[model samples]
Target: MYDFLIIGQGVAGSLLAWELAKAGKSVFVIDKGNPYSTSNVASGIVNPITGKRFVKSWLMDEIQPFSLKCYREIEHDLNVNFLSELSVYHVLNSVQEINDWSAKAATFHYEKYLSTSEIHYLDKEKVRNPNGCFEINGALKISASNFLSAIKNWLEAKYCYSEEVFEEAALNESRDFVEYKNVRAEKAIFATGYDEFFLKKHSNVKFSPVKGEGLVVEISDFFSENIVQGNVMISPTMAKGIYYVGSTYEWNFRDELPTESRKSELIERLKDTINCNFKVLEHVAGIRPASADRRPILGFFPNSRIGIFNGMGTKGFSLSPYFAKHFCDSLVAGKALLPEVDLKRFF
Candidate 1:
């Protein structure tokens, strides 16, 4: 019998399992291996400066350090390098936006990490972004696939993984433990991506899934180690001269397949922003299990043998480690959860 049975091996489950095992708890995970699992296709850019107004990320000081520490520890454990400290250059479009950024810079001392420095020597042939845009300091690129695989492999080594779709019929809950198939655990944690809709029986948990589309492009020029952010973001790939460019967040769509409309929109934006040409290497889409409030939802079910750790939204890379460790602590130690992100908000 395991101490925990985790459904879905996406970022949420993977990181939570890692935290639980680190704390010496037995954990089991089940995944159906969806390639477009939000974690797999995510650009995994942990940006501290976010949104149209460029406000600081939620709890940047606390979450950033904790997540960096976790990723570094896992890197050593897995013998893989997946995290990179990269600056994000946020392009300023208008005088008003520029002023807003400058005001935040002064008010928050954003100059410490953000700046208006000009980037020199981009491969002028492949990319289309205009030159000399203002830059921000806080961005980290993570190889989401590599990091997820590392944790998955670790779970496999412990003989605690099932590569099958989780069926409701397989679950059995008692006052204390929940059982699925032969695996029994004190509690079950669901991190099932957009399928969180399946948990609506609880009534309090609400998931506002957003469909996001991305493109993997091969560009012979305009390569940089720093991440570029404007309307969308461009993260460098492991292979030379390739980049993952994307992401259009559409709240009205439920389809996870890439659409021609989104493709055209993204292509047009990229061309207008960069002023260059590149070949599209791939098109991918996933529905992020974003919550209505835009913060993660973590809490236990009332009068039930279960807990949940999900609703990471697009900032999964920034939010997962902090919440995973927090959830593990709460599970094992009966700790108090932060009220802002706790499911108590919905309650």
Candidate 2:
């Protein structure tokens, strides 16, 4: 019997297993092994500031450093390089935005994350930086595809990972433990990302899962190590001259499979964002398990051994590491999770 049975191997589940293992708990992680999952195809841009108003992300001050440290530790253990410090250039639309950015950057709290010196026009031959742009410090990029694959390989080495869909019908739960296919564990946690059917059926938790579409593009004239945030996110991939782009977040979507309209929309945005021509390399989509409250949900359903860790959404990259440790602490030491993220918020 394992100490824990983890369903899913996205960033959430993988990190949960990693943290639990660190706390001396044995884990068996099961995954459907879909490479096109949000965690794998995501641009993985851990931006400190976001949104139309350019407000700071939730708890970015604490999450950023902690996540960087955690990813570094993971790299050391796995002998892989997947995390890197990168500047994010937030494109300015007009002179008014430039002034607003300058004011925000001048503030003492925002100063640490936003840079005032780098506000300048990009090469006109490459990106369409008409009104120039300002740089954001403390931004990071996670080599998501490689990172997830490495973690899976590491888990497999310990004989703790399986590439298969979790079957709920085969699960058996007791007062203090759960058994799935004859494998028993003290608790079973669902870190299933956007596939949060368990939480929906069992609890009063409200999910506002958003469908996202993305594109892989090849811009021959564009070359930058930094992330460009404008109409569309132009993030560099591992391959030269190729980038991860688009990622239109639709609150309403027909299905997870990409639509032709979104594909054309992203291409149009790409053309408007950059001056150089780009060839569409690929189109992809994934549903992010965001909650209505926009907070992560983590806890056991009342009087049950089944627990859930879901609703990380687009910010999963920056949000998962510290919260994984938080969950581990709560489970191993009986520490309490913050109310905002706890399932108590719902029921």
Candidate 3:
């Protein structure tokens, strides 16, 4: 029997599998290969401070370093470069907002992530920074699709990956283990993003799906190594002269399809942020597997052999590595999970 069977090869599952493999446990991963999945379309931006209030992301200190370490190790293992460390410039909208940032910069906790120096406008003619901006340290722009692809390749080489849909009807459970199709494992983990069919079995954990849309644009004379964040975020990709500009969060949506309305909204915001000549190259959308309390849902079923690791949400790139290590330890070494993220609270 295998140590674990992980369903879905998104960020959570891939990282968990990596951790388990590092612990010398046999693992198998199954993925459906959704081209427009959130991980595929995500800008993969990891920032310590976020939101209009510019508060530091939860557990940034602990999670950020772990995530970087994991990604660097993966890069060495896969012999590919997908992680880019970049500075993020938060465009200040008003004098009051600048004052708020300054006030927050004075705090000891915020000082590490917040920059107190005068913000530099890379292109004064092309970019708009009327009230200037603040620089955030230790931000990352990961190529999530490439990272997942590398992990999938690694799993395939080990003969532990299958590109197929996971059917709930195929799962068989017993006291010692669970069996699915021809594969039997001591435990099963469902890391599928926003797919409620299997998750419905755990009625206590509520998932809130948010459909987000992003766009790729080709800009001329916009040269900056740093990511720009205003009303919208514009991130540089590996492709020369092309930038990923996004994104709109629509809580109520019909499906995970790109909408012209959001496209126009993004373009308007982009134009407001910069005066560079640009054309839309691509538009994509995906649903985020968020939670009601905005924390990850992770734990085993109360009376079954199955477990779940979901709800990394918009912060998946930043949250997955650390939590995956934690979950893996809990699974393999009988460690206690963090009380905040434990699914027992929902139950």
Candidate 4:
């Protein structure tokens, strides 16, 4: 019998499995192999400062360091280069914005992350930055696709991974363990991203699914070492001259398919950000399992063997590692989860 049976091999499940294995727990991971799953299509940008207001991300102090440590350790273990440390430059359109950033930079908390020097324009021939920009250090552009693929290979070699859809009907729960398709585990945790169909039976977690679209484009004569965020964000990829540009957040969407409208919108925004010529290489879309409260959904069902760890949303890259460690400790050492992230609030 395995110590844990985890459903879904997205970011959440993959990280949780790694943590559990480190704790000397036997784990079995089931992945449906959905190509369009959020993790598969995620740009994997971990920004300490986010949104238009330039507010620091939640738990940035703790999450940023822990996430970097986790990814670096995994990179060493897997012998893969999936994590790229990059600086994020946010456009300062007006004098007031620049002054606001300057004021914030003087503060002890924001000093380290915010750049004190002003950058008028990244590339005068490419990007249009009128009033200059402020920098956020310790940003990361993680290649989630490559990382997951590496994890899958490792798990397969250990005979702990399967690529199959999980059916609730196949799950058998006993007093001490849960069994699925002849595989028994002491407990089961669902980290199934936006596929929360089974959540209805376990808890009253409500998900506000947000469909996000992004584009891969080839830009000519555009060279940058840092991520540029103006009207849109342009992040460097592994391929030369190719950048990942996106993304549009839409709450009302019929399906997860990429829309021509969003593509056009993104291109227009890209054009507004850059003056260089570009060609669209690909357009992708996925649904984010954002919670109603905009925090992660974690913890177990009352008096049951089932548990959940989902709803990292757009901040998945920044949030997953820290919480995965937290949840793992809670599971293995009887430690209590943080009250803010505990699902009891929703209950």
Q: 92-158, model 3: which lDDT tens digit per residue?
A: 8888888878888888988778756565555568878877778888999898778989999999999
**Better-scoring candidate (TM-score), 1 or 3:** 3
Candidate 3 residue-pair clash tally: 0
Worst-scoring 10-residue span by lDDT in model 2: 195-204
The digit string of per-residue lDDT tens for model 1 on 9-81 reads 9988999999999899989999998777788999888888888888888888788778888999999988988
Q: What does the lDDT read for residue 117 in candidate 4?
A: 59
Q: lDDT for each of the candidates?
A: 0.81, 0.87, 0.89, 0.88
TM-score of 4: 0.97
Candidate 1's displacement at residue 13, Å, is 0.7
- Candidate 1: C-alpha lDDT: 0.81
Query: What's the C-alpha lDDT at position 180 in model 3?
Result: 93
The prediction achieving the highest TM-score against the true structure is: 3
Query: Rank by lDDT, descending?
Result: 3, 4, 2, 1
Candidate 1: regions farther than 4 A off = 115-131, 196-199
TM-score of every model versus the real structure: 0.94, 0.97, 0.98, 0.97
TM-score, predicted candidate 3 vs. hidden true structure: 0.98
Model 2 lDDT, residue 337, Cα: 97
Tens digits of per-residue lDDT, candidate 4, 164-246, equal 98888999999989999989999999999887466566447877879999999999999776799999999998788988997
Write down the worst ten-residue block by lDDT for model 4: 195-204
